[model samples]
Target chain A: MFAVHTEDLRKEFTLKKGLFERRTAVAVDNISLTVKEGQAVAFIGPNGAGKSTTIKMLTGILKPSSGKAQVLGLDPWRQRSRLVRQIGAVFGQRSQLWLHLPPKDSFELLAEIYSLDKKSKQYKSRLEMLIERFELAAFLNTPVRKLSLGERMRAEIAASLLHRPRLLLLDEPTIGIDVVARQRLRELLAQWNREEGLTVFLTSHDTGDIEAVADRVILINHGRVIIDDTIDGVRHYGAPKSADTGEPPDMQSLPALEKVLSDLFTAK
Target chain B: MLKTAQKLIAVAKISARANLAYPGEVLGRGTFLLVVLYIFLKLWQATYSESGQSKLAGLSLAEMLWYLTITESMWMSAPKLAQQVDEDVRTGSLAVKLIRPLSYPLYCLSANMGERLVRFSFNLALGACIALALVGPIHLRAEALLMLALSVCLAFLLDGLGHLIVGLSAFWLEDTSGLYLIYTRLTMILGGMLIPLDLFPGWLKNLVVYLPFPYLVWGPVHLLSTPQAELAASFLELAIRQLACLVALSALVALLWQRALRRVSAHGG
Candidate 1:
């Protein structure tokens, strides 16, 4: 039950430029790696470090430019419909849930989309349990746009898990969440993974999100992997020892993540 | 299918609630359309009175006013230029639709139709009621009833086509809003909502008859009064042309959407 495998998975984008500038940008450079079954993998990098581009290709949301990949024993790009049912993807920047409809309505909608009969008590019980655990009972009938961010994310997670998928892909899963809510989400993920043997591949800027959920880190920068190793290995490789003030020297002197990533790309 | 229809109904119901939330937009748009409609009515009357004219096309001033009112409401509510479609593509929201078993275009079509259903009903109740009070009951012959139903369905299809063009273009164009606006204005000006197509010169009418613009408004209204033989021929012509446009443009939309997905994945959308 291989969870993910890639062979030189590459993606490129055409550049919009003036007469003299380069005509393309390599958004995801050639890369190859595998995550075993039930492993909690963290893909971490500054924005535009090819993290999302790589995830999109893995989830079959986008195709690779010059390589191949497989997820759960299927070609993600070629067999998207078959692959989709086996995994759930949550995109924090955008949502799959209907804005005007209630969370329950969107859940039913997805159930219909996945073509699972609503009368199936097995699925019904699973959904109910998820709703309860995620604390969605309060806002089950509330329209999605009206739900608080934490509530929305909870419902979003619940919606994705309705089918008991074997794998979950969460992009910025804990973004915009308060500390307590983020912790709760991590707890839920860990429990579900242990109980159901579910595999989670997460990408987040929150160190806590990575620390709590992912044992392995795939650190990327400028569309290439800087390190792909165990979390401790990544830490030992050369994380900036925190200044006594608990802030990195890079952060004290740098504008933001965007600037940091830009500097990395420019210097590299 | 029932679920899809129910979903659309839900969309319509929710839109009604949303309208309540934004009272200002409802009031502002309603008043803007009414004032614009009133001015058109006054201008038409002034022109006819100045010419010492009474009627043309066997229609009195009141009947023409009725036509203008319905046209304006339909213009405001017409199903073209789906606002959500462009955003759906640019924001990658359509990805949500793709994972669903529901057909993508069909889902969008239903949601949009739900919205238009609300607009059409509101306009019929508000705009039509006021006009009938000022003017009178619009006489609908038996054949005219059929034509109205047929043309209105065709109108919906035309509106979908308008949105389809813009929605599909988003895959290729970085920003599609300006182009959609230009396209919308062209239809409004030429679709007989601004003025009766009959009022246009003979050559212009002939030219537009071949184009898809007249089917949007004038064709249906014209079918309301025209003889059976002529209406049948025109209806058949319009149906075929509309179907043709639907197929050709639908194919183009599919192609562009596929290419766009590939582009976004490669570009990190």
Candidate 2:
């Protein structure tokens, strides 16, 4: 079964120009795509490309202007409460942590919010695994306000996973972090996708994130999907050929891949 | 249903904990409460002597000062709920809240109540000490204290609902601060924060009694000041009015929230 399926999805926002005047902006314009269960797909686009709008629609935070969307075989707009239980999201710019409290408290509160049995074996094991995997034990009791951005984001991801969601939606999860922390996050995400078979829907401008985590790349521009292909396909589709082998540049490393993707985006 | 309640309670607990994280700020607020209580005590003293009555509106100068203390503490402890909601809406952080499985309105209500409870406890404690120093202790009954406790809880819930209603108006209004200012001022004047309802002209008191404002402050505080024998009867009447207001405000909040959902245009990526 598909984890996410949308058919001709659209979202238009109305703006008030002045008294007795209104303008309609099409944010997500008739986009249709699907991600099979456990597929790690990257949703990338330039600003105002409606990537966020599409994510919002799928998360049931905003109603679509038209078309159909089913998440986990449930209608997002009509059955958001139920759908939200099976899905988790991390918007890098927005925090779910209580700023004044430690991550431990936030995690405890989240366990309650998700109605997880705190004393259950499953809950205990999941918490232990997340703590170990996310490297959260060191600062778990430190207040969120005092934690470094990297620590907080690690905690944020761990908190989202506490419910054992089948699908995870991440928006720029590695943005604004040091290189070491960024690589660690990317590795963790890729590991989660590979081992847990979690369906990952990531949106990021960082090519390193795309290279390390996403298996498939779905690029959108002006509210429509422009390209959908495997990461290697995307890398070689428009990349400059090498003088030595008449093949794409050796974009095996982070910096080289980043330059290729940057060139691709610029060419688009 | 039980699970929902537990979720709300958890949210409240976390909010309370977060509010307590900054002891210096809470203590700063306590200092301000001390000053306000002192000012009210002096002003009420002057009013009592000038009137040449030991009691005005059936309250001795001491009871009057005590009443002011309770009302001021309640006012000072109010969480900036409307402003928080306004910020959430304006900044698009509301989207983060909506993604959660819990109802957004209930989550907000719980958080507000939690913060308010902690702040109110601190303010009331300090205010009580100041009141004790200024006017000595007024005669009190155990039953009156129980009634005060119950009514105060209901009052906070009712007031939180009112703030939620104002905050939800942010979906349409360019800004909610003006609306919040007006709402609070109305509560202060009509809710009898500055003066007891008993002191209002008979017509004004009668009018405000029919509104929710009086129930938020006057009704609850009045229950504490009532004679012991009448405490039960006053509480019964006040509880009924408060429940009725709760029902109406809750319905309005539900409606506003449903409409607000459709208007959500999350601001940024």
Candidate 3:
């Protein structure tokens, strides 16, 4: 079974004015997609392009106006609490941790929320492993308010993973971090993807985040999927071909990848 | 049920620990509330002297002062659930909260209760100091005091639920602070925050007693000042009314939260 599947899901919002006037906005139009288990899918789109909206619907934060979505064979909206138990989510700009307390406290609180056996050896080792893997030992005791954006993001991801979720959904996870921090985050996510076979559904605009971590790319615009292909297929699109033989464009240049994406973003 | 309790306790504990991080802010607000109490003491004393009555509406001067102290402590230290909910909804941060395996309203209620309990303790102690300095000591029977504590705890839940209802209006309205301000004023006058209900005209007192607002502040404060002989009778009557209000308010929260969830889903957050 696919880790994620949606069939023509849609969401409509109505806005009302002072008197009798109303306007309807279609945030997520008829959109259907699927992700295989352990697939690293990068959902890239422009601003206001329904990427986050789709993720929200799939994660049960929002209910679709029409159609259906099943994450791990369970209806996302109907089984939200149960679904959330097996899925992790992180929003780069929003925090789930208490700002005034250390990440250590947040983690403990999360453990309780997830009903983990904190005294068991397996849970203890897993906690230690995550701490070590994320390199959170140094700043784990510091208040979240005092941490830099990058550190807080890392901590947020760590806390989300304490439940050992099978699928991880990230919304703009690398939006505002420095180069080194972003690179580190990308590497850590890649490791989780490769070693643990964790299914990842990520929404991001950053080319580096997509290139380094995602194997499959789904480009969306105006509430519809424009392109769904492997990274190689994406790289090959709109590149300069050899004049005489109509050969595939060279993939070695970084500019060619950026050009292809820029053209795709600007295309009708 | 046990696991749910454990999780809620953890949530509350974390919230309480977060509250401890802002000692200076707590102290500043506590001091400000103490000043308000002192001013009320002076105002009440002058009003009694001018009226040339040793007692006004069934309460002695000292009893009235103590009643004000209890109500003010509750009012001043109540959690800002409405503003917090409004901000969360507006900023879309509430989406993060929704994904957790917890009810958003319950989480907010638990967190608010934890923080309010801490702040209430600090305010209660400070108000006691001011009350003693101004009105001298007012003796209380142990049973009446116990009943007062029970009523106040229920009042906190009732008040918090009321705030939640107001806060959830943000799901439909653009802002809820204005509504909360109105609610606070209504609760103050109609709920006996500013003056005892007995002091009000009989018709007005009777009408106000039927609403949940009276149970929020007036009921508890009234019990706190009741004589020991009548404590049992008064406590039983008040408990029944408060429980009825609690059930009704809890139902309202459940219904409104369900509606808010629909709005949130439609709006893509």
Candidate 4:
């Protein structure tokens, strides 16, 4: 079964004003896409392009206005708890940990929330070992609110992965993170992707996040999927060809990837 | 089941520990409330003396002043559920609460109750010191005192009900401040936060007797103001009314919670 799928997915919201104002917003316009099992799909869009809205819908945080979607062969809105257990999520720029609690304690709370087996994942030992792997032992007891931004982001990502879920959904997971932190996160994600073959669906404005992590790209604009292809396909289909032997533009430069997105979205 | 309760207790305890880190703010608010209670005591005493009646509305000058002091402190510390709900909606933070394997309303209730219990202890000490220092002693007969304790507990239940109703408005209205203001004013007038319930016209008192508003202050004030012999009969009647209000309010909370969750799943914050 497909790990994630959506058919004509759409989300509309009504403003709180009078009927005469007739203000309606189509946060996620009718869009369709699918991700195969164990595939890493990156959903890339501009700030107001309904990327977060789509993630929220698939996570069952919201209901689509008109569409069909599934996560891990289950309807997320209909079976939220069961579907959520199979999927791990980390919303960028928002720390789920209690501001006053230590990073280790926050991990315990996350473990309890996910109901991970205490016998197997004894929180203290497991969380400490996980932190050690990330070179985070020196900041073990520090409160999350007091930690540096990079360290805190690492903590957030670790907390989200404690249950070892098969599907990971991250929204803008590396927006303003430093190079070192981003690199660590990228390595961990790659390890999870290669060993566990975890399926990841991510939304990011940063192309580096997409390039370093996702194998396939899904570009969205005005709430619609304008292009869905591999990183190489994005270059061939969405960018101009180089003069050298009529080859496609080089894809290594980050700004070049962004330029392709801007041109495509602007054209719409 | 036990584990969930333990986790909730841990949450409550940890919340308390974190809040204690900011004791200075608590002390300041307590002191300000005490000062306000003291001024009201002097003003109420002068009013009674000028009236020249042995009792005004069946309460002695001292009894009336003490009642005001207690009610002022309690009402100021009313449950803050509406503001919490408003904040969750405004910040899109409610999504975090929803993803957890817990009922959102229960979470809010436990947190609010734990915080209120802490405030109850702090304000009690501070208000008692001011009351005793300014006015000698508050006379209480055995039955009146017993009913007085029961009445305070009932007031908390009533306050929770009021907050639940107000907070549920957030599902529809973008803000609950307007609803909160209306509820507060109604409680102050009908619940006898300003004027005593007995001082209201007989028909008006009869009308509000069954309402939760009166349970908030009317029950406590009447218990504190009346003698032991009079309170014995009133206690049985008031207890039944408060019990009914609690049951009805709980059912209302459950209904609203279902509606709110349904809306949240279908719509964005």
Considering the two chains of model 4, state its CAPRI-style docking category: acceptable
lDDT of 3 by residue, A113-161 (tens): 9999999998899899899999999999999999988898889999999
> How would the docking of model 3 be graded?
medium
> Whose lDDT is higher: candidate 1's or candidate 3's?
3
Per residue, candidate 4 scores C-alpha lDDT tens digits across A76-105 of 888887877778787776668778767876
lDDT of 2 by residue, A1-268 (tens): 9999999999999999989899999998899999999999999987888988999999999999999999999999999999988999999988999999999999999999999999999999999999999999999999999998889999999999999999999988888999999989999999999999999999999888998999999988888888899887776655544433665566552235566566656664
lDDT of 1 by residue, A1-268 (tens): 6899998889887776876776877888888889888989988787788887887788777788888799999998888878888888888767877776688877876776666778989888988899888989988988888987888898898899987788898888888989888999988887777777888898888777887888888878877877788765554434343533554334344334333333444555
lDDT of 4: 0.75
What TM-score do all the candidates reach, one by one? 0.86, 0.96, 0.96, 0.85
Candidate 1 residue pairs in clash (backbone atoms < 3 Å): A113-B101
Which candidate gets the maximum lDDT versus the true structure? 2
Give the alpha carbon lDDT tens digit for every residue of B140-224 in model 2. 7888888888888899999999999899999999988889999999999999999999889999988888899998888888877
Q: Rate the local accuracy (lDDT) of all candidates.
A: 0.74, 0.90, 0.87, 0.75
How close is chain A of candidate 1 to the true chain A, as a TM-score? Answer: 0.87
Query: How accurate locally is residue B184 in candidate 3, as Cα lDDT from 0 to 100?
Result: 93
Candidate 4's C-alpha runs over 4 A off are A15-18, A21-25, A36-38, A101-121, A133-143, A175-198, A241-255, B1-11, B53-66, B137-154, B217-239, B265-269
Q: What is the descending lDDT order?
A: 2, 3, 4, 1
Worst 10 residues of 4 chain B by lDDT: B260-269
Off by over 4 Å in 2: A240-268
Residue B194 CA error for candidate 4 (Å)?
Answer: 3.6
Task: Please write out the lDDT profile of model 4 over residues B46-74, one tens digit for every residue.
Answer: 87878888677887766776777677767
